[model samples]
Target: MGKKFLKSDEEVVDPKATLEVSCKPKCVRQLKEYQACTKRIEGDESGHKHCTGQYFDYWHCIDKCTEVQMQSAACSIHCICGFSFALYSLYCMFLLIWSMERSDEEVVDPKATMEVYCKPKCVRQLKDYQACTRRIEGDESGSKHCTGQYFDYWQCIDKCVAPKLFEKLK
Candidate 1:
């Protein structure tokens, strides 16, 4: 008998070709619906016909993306937006505007926000900063790089968290 090749239902269906393969199907649907809503918001004549009170859901989608973007940025040095890093950039822009729009009393500094968002990473950076300072001053006492040691606080912190701080600095 000749060998037979069999294809599973998923392979036949090719969900990757469609928009239905994600674990978060609801989020995917929300993104599509929100894009449709935005077309109407842009005053597109064709879009207005399908958009009735759906605009509110559009805003909710934006809010959701922002939350996910911030979360992904915090947890992983890489963004969860995946190949669509631009969406994450949009999320950062939205965050910047949202933070600025708040009143002075409500506004939180970036350090406080960073501490909350990326606590472990931030604390590690702080420790690195301290260590770097000891090295720059040539203090061998309790220094890990102990043997005629000198440290640069600026260099260590800057080196450890340069990429992270670059985002905020910009």
Candidate 2:
């Protein structure tokens, strides 16, 4: 059987940049619904009781939009670049492993390696940030409760994690 390639009906925006500006029709409809829900929530003082379900639906619509965008981007990259990027990534991974093995003569403590990579507090904060992202992956509307936590996490990574990790590399 012959392999099917690009969808003949799909509009190509930029073959080089792989960006699709127009979303699918269903996504457009869902976006309209989400916007209407938002407007209603904003206008009504007691809208929270009635709008929670709509908010979840809106969140799901946005999530689907993101999924479609990512899928299209991946398809564009694969179609344009083929296997070159994949091969390069594999080559880099090989070099990293080879270099690590070459330094095996020196006794390296795993704990020390981790400490050099990031401070203990930074590591905890990073984990918390990751967990928060995962927790809100399905219900991103809940992220408001985590805004301060996210800020702290990024601050730790910027001020403590990056410096330690870069210094260790040097």
Candidate 3:
């Protein structure tokens, strides 16, 4: 391989995107219907001609094929991972409560509860970050950035969350 200095900046492609492109061939019929609807309504000045039905039909077809593919694929590899994680966590919590794996004293979500405590302590840092954002709003030149301020705000939150986050996750 040739020496590539900017390899670290390479874009990450989601597996689900590839799956969707593969499933597109199965939905070509719906796709053509949508395309035909648009073509048939191309120059209608009366505004009566519309393709809402065909548009949704195509989307429905794509979603059905995507669902089938998702069932056969690893959910962790999907694009909607955050949503899946949230639902999974809620399910796990429900199961834990039913199985008596977690006691009443154990915090179900420590990071959220801790953030409430952490935020107030870091109000000054938060204000500094907010002020930096406001200052950057007027800078048309791309040289200005609020990265330091952004990091400062997040660093405060992370510090406050760190002490109890691992303990709660356990």
Q: Evaluated with lDDT, which candidate comes out highest? A: 3
- Candidate 2: deviation at residue 164, Å? 55
lDDT digits (tens) for residues 35-125 of candidate 3: 9978865765555446787789777766766655555354333423345577775664455444343222222245656888899989989
- Runs of candidate 1 exceeding 4 Å displacement: 1-3, 6-11, 15-19, 26-36, 46-170
lDDT tens digits, residue span 1-170, model 2: 46656798987656323322332343455457667757744534432213454557545544545454555445555545546678755655555455445422333434335545555667777677778756754552442334556678657655655555566673
Candidates' lDDT values, in order? 0.45, 0.52, 0.67
Higher TM-score: candidate 1 or 3?
A: 3
lDDT tens string, model 1, 34-122?
Answer: 67756634643332133443555544544544544444434343333343677766776565555445412222345434434454544
Which structure is stronger by TM-score: 1 or 2?
A: 2
Worst 10 residues of 1 by lDDT: 142-151
Error of 2 at 108 (Å): 54
Best by TM-score: 3
Clashing pairs in model 3? none
Off by over 4 Å in 2: 1-21, 35-43, 46-50, 82-170
TM-scores of all predicted structures: 0.19, 0.27, 0.38
